[model samples]
Target: MAQAARLDIMSIAALVAFALTLGARTTFCEGISCGPGWEAFSSSCYKKMVDPNGWLGARFHCVLEGGDLVSFNSSAEEDFVKGKMGARSFWIGLSNLECNHKLCPQVSGKELKWSDNTLLNHSNWATVKVASTNLESCAYVLPNAHKDYHPGKWRKVSCESSLAYMCKRSPDGCQEGQPCNKTAGLALTPVQTSACDPGDFLRGHFCYRFENTKKTWQGAEDDCVLWGGHLASVHSREDGDWLIAHMEDNFHVGLKKNIKMFEWRDKTAMDPALWYPGYPSSDDCGRVSRTGQVYNHQCNSLIVFTCQKGVDVTHRHHQAHLVCAHLRSFSHPCSPAHSTSAAPRLE
Candidate 1:
């Protein structure tokens, strides 16, 4: 019997030692804290900002800081943020631009995509609706015990509404152009445009040149493709106006038919077909000419053409310029134009 008790005591001692080792490796402290502008989130930290600016302006601010607006990824994340925010209202990075500004319930199944084309595939939303003004086409979250709506509820409001907000950064790596400055308190600086010259016919998200160089529809398409872009397809009247503003002469876009009279080359047909009123007639297949303030064109006739591709600043300076011109110009600064303190923010 004495031997049995001794064996049991030995087993208890081994268990105690194992637990102590584990506790050392995974220590949890009560009331742990992070630096200013940062709130504790599980094992990481987040920054919350309250911008009184409208939705568009708020979005600009977040991008200026090299981050998209807030997109919650989980219920626990939302609840944790709410607890940190206390009773204040804050903006989240979501909008119903595609849905005509209506409030959407907690998005399920496929994740939502932001206007800049970023995916909000993670969790970070409430299941209830909060008070919002009709002018409020944007959404925000409130943190409090008021579970008046279920947890993770989102309130749609006007973009013009002023509210507090939260910002998140991956504790693992800082975004490019944003440095972790211990002295500056984690605030992001604006990204700088490089000194490289703009490529062949591209400037600021629009592709163009000052002189009209003659080429066939096929030739123009080939030139654009050589530059790693295809012929342009104007999406809106605004696009037409933009093209007109830069051109010293008329140009052609892809929209031609083969000798067989079948429509080819104009790749934009794959997208929702958009044309000026009374456009795309049998005779107008490849025609584009500028008349005073308007543009007219035929697909088969040769005129200078514009092509476009997306831009990435991280690319080599020359390559970036070539790519930007081939795709489209980076016309808008990464930051919006209205704020002097704000810098350009790209996706």
Candidate 2:
């Protein structure tokens, strides 16, 4: 409550106008309340990001805000989205794509699921099947831009296509008549992660920890997320070498082999020479041996693993006034800026 009650001293009117056009005027809309920059419906919070970016970039933006690209569980959610989202094509979380060698290629049998890995139970496909290629495997919601185009329906397209997007998350705990700590620009009340948790080693922009307990690839990844990190990703040989030297045992990594190539779990560029020769021929998951050699393995196999998260994300604050239409710089682990490896010192 102490953190949520902190008021950063912005004019109430200004805060409302800047963040998604919601102010005190709409706080009680539909008998629900959300943070200053979000709208509430059903049991979740929604924000429409008008700035156009690629699907990956847009998802990262939502991640920085502690959410993910919007996922619809039912038609009611879909209809709710249709009413709030503007009449412009926007990226939703549904995709049958995976990052492979810097390209978003279609997986042979992957279904269009939400980014959080939820199976699609309901859909509003544009009533046509668009053949997916190496580049056209992502789905986007179409707006009423054309009389012939069906608004609120979805279509498959290239992940690289720049489009606006929507983000969804549980609402910040603020009821009507409560003081919302959020500010305009959806700063979302930046929280301080000044240091990694105890026993985690701070290195460069991330903290790394080797887990001794064996767990399946998906299990390891989920544990990392629960610990505020992910299975460690290697973007350079130096980082790979560090992992080889410091990590204690074989483990599942964030990289996964798909379509004959390996892609980093965070979707950063992968080092081409990190794999052991004759390895990674046709496995679904990735593991790094003690020698730093990358290998592909069955995703359901159990193994120890490593986790990594940004070292520190400085708290950000902006006041006075901010224009509502554009996105600010990303200052967290989800951004590519935090992906590089720096000199490591275990604490």
Candidate 3:
């Protein structure tokens, strides 16, 4: 009878423990809080920046603060946004276009996708079909821009159009410094060396430098050109990842709003893979954070920027020397050319 009583007590204890575990998870939202000036709702936090920027610039500011443009998942969330936005139009996290390349690629389908890859289960478009033209694929919500700004109505616009943007973040993820760390054990393969001037770092086929002086977007671009390169054109996720790994603070990227879609300064199609997702819209220029996310912003804003230049002939000769060094090490198959000259080491 004593054993039976103890067993019954153990079962009750276990049941109570399970209840406590469930309760803690339910209260996690309570424990997590947004940063100052950010509003909290459910499990996420939001802040509306009144500064005018292209869609990309707005998204960059949010990412710099550890979030992205707000993405809506339900009618309630949409309604909540409507209430928060009040009578002003603002950029959201929806865009049908991707522009990391020199040119914006045509999407296969007309359906709009969220930059954050949120599920497209619910929508509150003002029109039955979203107008996704080749040049205008970035989206925004017009809750009360005017009497005609239908509540909950969505509009697709050219990414270059500047407007105030809204940012959203989950309170659980808000604690802060650099969120992405240099990946251990995954050594990047050295592709080429450069005779880049002091302060420049070589990565793959190009050399990059973060200028100390701040300038307006156009002025920055001009400076890059004068230094024998253009503003950096990030082509892939690898590029973005590598960039953020080495860069600090928010800086201008190379994307600019064209007639309809965003384009790289060099006129190449953008690699969608480089974006943080749901980005590069309704802005004439781009900005990046230490997190490696790309965002739209205004062209006239004064900010620090990055630059890129191709390896010159001196670097090419260094690459040849490296190739010769590899051949010399394999003495069994060493050729006369390898034996005649000592391999020059490139720093």
Candidate 4:
């Protein structure tokens, strides 16, 4: 999420390449503090992003900043966010994109989820009752001060609507009992100040690092494995767009033609329909271009690649809650599975 702090990102399609160099920055930290422009509120730090973007794109920017789209877990939190928003509607981390009425609990018949993958325990919706359908939808908060809109109320909209967004992160900076120097202002990391590694970008609870160092597909995957992660895996259009936004040229991604289908090393299920145009399905490796197109590639070809790592317990627990909640909807008594099997690391 390093890129989010520096750019307004009103339109990622207009992004320009910029130079960024980092020294030896590693993952794992000890403490944190709210940086400039971030307000300390309750248990987290809040930052209002002044940019227009679709819900997914907005959330992507927040993840770049080492956070996710803001989640108002209570009425007070909702009011706090309303007070922070100026006149613009801001995208929140709430959605019902995966809601299947039969498999999940319904809020107005729509199951909402936060970007952090948590279920909605509280709501601040207006008259807009999102229609239950298979189509994706998101929620955004309207400023009450505006006479034309409902005050402190969330409105359902297509996830494609561009709007300003809010971000929240756990404060991290020099602190007592940690190997840190209070004198060193801002954040003490190898790269920038974020929840993930200083340099890695956070997306959907996963941390990704883009490496420009060209290496063969296998060599790239090996290096990522050496670093305790795996090659990057693209999950959706947003993921593909995110890669295009940060990268300037063609790069290798973590997928290979295994028999008749492409497989993600991390075990993420592939959506066959997501592959566009066509990937002759012949080459052994996968490559992505700045335009978000995938191609069949020779495994030994040298190219830059990305690496990905797992998230913390909070994120994992959120996933478990989602699955458990679904199972419970079927009347099956079950407990939340707090952990998951380790899969191949992805960049």
| Candidate 3 lDDT tens digits, 40-62 | 87767888777555454455445
Report lDDT (Cα) of residue 306, candidate 3. Answer: 86
lDDT of 2 by residue, 1-347 (tens): 01111111112112222332332433322333555567888888888876666565565455544456788888999888877776656778876644221122234334566775556787788765544332224677765422333556786654434567787876744323222333212443322211344334445556777687899999999999998889999766666655654444567889876566678878765576777778756678888765566778899998788899764423211211121112233222111121222223321
Error of 3 at 71 (Å): 0.6
- Per-candidate Cα lDDT values, in order, are 0.42, 0.56, 0.55, 0.56
Q: Per-prediction TM-score, please?
A: 0.33, 0.38, 0.39, 0.39
| Superposition error at 227 for model 3 (Å) | 34
lDDT of 1 by residue, 215-305 (tens): 8766777777776666666654445544443443466665554543434354433122344446545554443334212233554565555
Quote the RMSD, in angstroms, for model 2.
Answer: 19.0
lDDT score, candidate 2, position 301: 91
Candidate 3 Cα misplacement greater than 4 A, ranges: 1-32, 99-110, 145-149, 174-347
Query: What's the lDDT for candidate 2?
Result: 0.56
Where in model 2 is the C-alpha error above 4 Å?
1-33, 98-109, 128-136, 172-347
Q: Output the worst ten-in-a-row residue range by lDDT, candidate 3.
A: 178-187
RMSD of each: 21.0, 19.0, 21.2, 17.3
